[model samples]
Target: MDYQIARHNMVENQVRANKVTDPLVIAAMEEVPRELFLPESKKGVAYVDEDISIGNGRYAIEPMVIARMMQIAEIETTDVALVIGAGFGYSSALLSRVAETVVAIESDATMVEKAEKILQDNNYDNVIVVEGDVVAGYPKQSPYNVIMFDGAVAEVPEAILAQLAEGGRLLAVVREAHKVGVARLYEREHGVIGHRDLFDANVPYLPGFEPVESFVF
Candidate 1:
């Protein structure tokens, strides 16, 4: 299907056109074979500017959304990263290119298996897919230089924020109630974690991250 051409077009038209200016981010998006990360039935449409479901209530978020998040995080070559809700491990693969090491957490067993296989087969050796509770954030490897939520969440848990290194940055699409989501970049400076809205996003919520229901009068 001429994936190379399709990939080039996706970078130039969907990602680059949307203000994802970081050269490393652009290069990673251009180099990764996103099609390999999707179900066979969805591969033909891999480069489309929309999320593609990968079963088990997970979606491979739109390329532009992830690209922008990476750029905002400003990942460094020697940083350690943790990706919550790794899904098919596409985002982790992208992080592996820019970060020294990556630990991806996924709750679903099937997903963890598939993600690990795909990553290993493709020689993305810097990333490891761990099967565990997604919202727990792999604290075993605390003090991550970068933490990314692969999907939208109602809130960012303090436990997750605690994993960020003093100068680390975390990125997530925060959606509350039914309102539109906001992509936020959280930074830890002087032991304080603060966040600023980067852009508006409306992507699927990672399982286990849904807001708790409240009682009504």
Candidate 2:
């Protein structure tokens, strides 16, 4: 299969058609062989418009959604990023192309192993895979200039927000209901984090990042 041509179509059709105009993001998505990150059975649909499940309840978010989120991030060339729920590390791999360094956090051991292997084989030395709690963020590399959550979350945790460097940007899909979610960008200035909705998207929930339910009787 000619993945380069297919990648061009993905960027031009699915991504740009959906309003993702950032050149860096487009280039990264174009360069990365997304099919390499998927299981053999799922590689055929890597660039399709839907999320491809990489197993363990994790899904590689749709290309347009991921591209749009990266566009909204306004990634800086010197920024260091953290990707929560890195999944198959596709997002992290894309991020490594934009950020100076990327620390990808994954809670699933199997997923982490797969992500690490692929990232290494592809020579993504700028990306480091870390196994730990996704909700907590990876503080060892705290105060990151960019932080991105790979899946939908009920709410962005304070712990994660606390890791954002001053003037840093953090993006996530905030799911308000079963089928409703909004992609939001949170930027910290003078130690205060301000947020605004970027777009509407619904992706698989990153386990442990969900909001705690209240009991009312």
Candidate 3:
């Protein structure tokens, strides 16, 4: 499959056609070899308009969703980023192109190892893959300029929000009742975090980010 051509079409059709106007994002999507991040069995469908599952409860979060998230974050060249659930490191590779440094956190040790190796083999020097609890947010690298959750979550942990630097931003798809979800962009300004819903999205939930069970008597 002419992967380059497929990448181009994904950017032009799925991303740009959906209103993602960031040139850098368009370029990153066009440049990144998304097939490399998927298992051999899934590579053929890398550029398709659906989320590709890489097993173990993780999905690559469709290309357009990623493009829109990056567009909303407004990543700057000087920014430091944290990617939660960095499955296969595809998103981290993209962020490495836009941010000064990227810390990608994964709870699964095997995924951490695999993603780190792939990103390094591909020359994503600015990204650091770490093994950690997804909800914990790597505090050692706290105060990130941008933070992104690769999949949907029921709520953004307060600790993770605290890790955002002043004027920093974060993005995620908040899954609500009846399986509905809203993509939201959150910004920290003067120590307060404010968010605005951007669009509708539906993706696999990041493991351990499920909503707390309510008591029903």
Candidate 4:
């Protein structure tokens, strides 16, 4: 398969055509070999304009959705980023291009191992894939300039928000069961965190982020 051509077409046809205007995000998407991040069986469909399951209920979300989220976050070249639910570390790879340093958290041991190998092999030196609970957020390196959830979640925990540096931004697709998801951005300023909806998305939810069930009496 001609991956370079397919990548170009993906950027022009799916991402750029969908209002993802940030040049940095566009360039990262164009440069990163997204196919390398997918299972071999799924690589042929890597550039399709839809989420590709990566097992354990996670996904490498649609390119346009991630691009729009990055654009909305306004990532800076010197910023430190934390990617929750790193999966195959694709999002972290994209971020490594634009951010100074990236810490990606994944709960699955096998995934962490594979993601680390792929990032290291590809020379994405700025990214560090760590195995840990995704919901906990990596507080050891708190006050991150940007925090991105790699998949949809039912809610954003305050603990995660607390890790945001003043003036930092966190982006996630917030979706409740049987409800539509909205891409939301949370920003911290003057010690206050405020969030606003960016766009609607129906991406899959990351494990351990599902809403707790309530039982009717």
Note the residue pairs that clash in candidate 4: none
- TM-score of model 1 vs. true structure: 0.98
Candidate 2 residue-wise lDDT, 27-47, digit = tens: 998999899888899988878
Cα displacement (Å) at residue 19, model 2: 1.5
After TM-score superposition, what is the CA distance of residue 211 in candidate 1 from its true location, in Å? 2.0
Candidate 4 on 181-214: residue-level lDDT in tens?
Answer: 9999999999999999988999989898887878
The clash numbers for all candidates, in the given order, read 0, 0, 0, 0
Question: What is the TM-score of each predicted model, taking all chains together?
Answer: 0.98, 0.96, 0.97, 0.98
Query: How many clashes does the backbone of model 3 have?
Result: 0
Better of 1 and 3 by lDDT: 1
Model 2 stretches with alpha carbons more than 4 Å out: 211-216
lDDT of candidate 3 at residue 34, scale 0 to 100:
98
Candidate 4 overall Cα lDDT vs. reference? 0.94
lDDT of 3 at 22: 90
In candidate 2, position 115 carries an lDDT of 93
